[model samples]
Target: MTTPRLTPHAYVLAVPDLTRTTAYFEHVLGFSRLWNDGDNWQALGRDGVRVMLGRCPDAIPPAELGDHSYFAYVEVSDLDGFHAEIAAKGALLGFPPRDQPWGRREMAVATPDGHRMMFANPIRA
Candidate 1:
């Protein structure tokens, strides 16, 4: 018997301010708002990625979580183009895309709340 693989369809993030957090995903990262439940919850999507944001004013902000705040690792094509586009849009970049010894090119960025995400593309020969 083989264990089934898990495919993540959406990520839920708690943010202090839903409106502001959604704005970062929308205005900066180029995600489109898919749904919303007034001030409590909102969903944003880009490409095939979906992110659900819930307002949580009392919880510790992601900025305080350090490495624990990282929530997503996404694989993408044309990473250099994506990097250039996001950089021009003022995305808070972690590092420019670079080839790694592990046979991939990777880049990283942090959301306004400090939730980190890594994007990668396979380095082709």
Candidate 2:
């Protein structure tokens, strides 16, 4: 029998933020600062995956460039506890966490740059 080949990487996101977005990831999400390209680009993460922030032009319009844009998915060991932690930290949560039919419990929050950050956990039997 032959084994099937699989893609190696699953990159999460490359979000855009003008200000305070990097702080939110470091302070709120507990990700460590990797590096910033200075002036316009910043990177942060704990694991191998890193979230890069790119600065938009001074007058660039809104980020309405279809759904192909970046969306961040953050996994938590304890969904309920994580949710509470976010609330306690005064994060502007978009909606309460809810279990989806796809066997995952999740919630979404918007970043300072309008990027959607999703907090999710797999539903166990």
Candidate 3:
């Protein structure tokens, strides 16, 4: 049987401050701003991983923060290295890398606005 192929395009996040969020992605994650389509809509990140920040009038609605749902899992060649980088850069929530039962080595972190971003690498038997 052939496993179905899948690809991710983008993720939408509601932020109180677009400028702050954009700057965080750039200065910390090394993401370059692709474009800002006015009013709170900003496209960011690179290489197929894009993060969209939308301005919210009040604090982010409860619906946006679904059941601990993560936007995406970014695969990096060096999770341990990135972990150290983010830690040094003062990521909101940084942790050491660990191998999980699901068969992946990962390190999870969150932005100041509470957006959880995870970097991981597939574990091979």
Number of the top lDDT candidate: 1
Can you write out model 2's per-residue Cα lDDT over 1-125, one digit (the tens) per residue?
A: 98998742333334445357778867776667777777687777755546776766553333464343336677878888987876787676777789999999998766555566688899878
Candidate 1 vs candidate 3, lDDT winner = 1
Given candidate 1, what's the lDDT at residue 34?
A: 95
Pairing residues by index, what is the TM-score of model 2? Answer: 0.71
Specify the poorest-scoring 10-residue window by lDDT in model 2: 7-16
Error in Å for residue 117 of model 1 = 0.3
Which scores higher on TM-score, 2 or 3?
3
Q: For candidate 2, what's the RMSD? A: 3.6
Select the stronger candidate by lDDT from 1 and 2: 1
- Let me know the TM-score candidate 1 reaches against the reference structure: 0.93
Off by over 4 Å in 1: 1-7
Give the per-residue lDDT of model 1 (tens digit) for 69-98. Answer: 989989988899989989998899989899
Ranking by TM-score: 1, 3, 2
Q: In angstroms, how far off is 53's CA in candidate 1?
A: 0.5
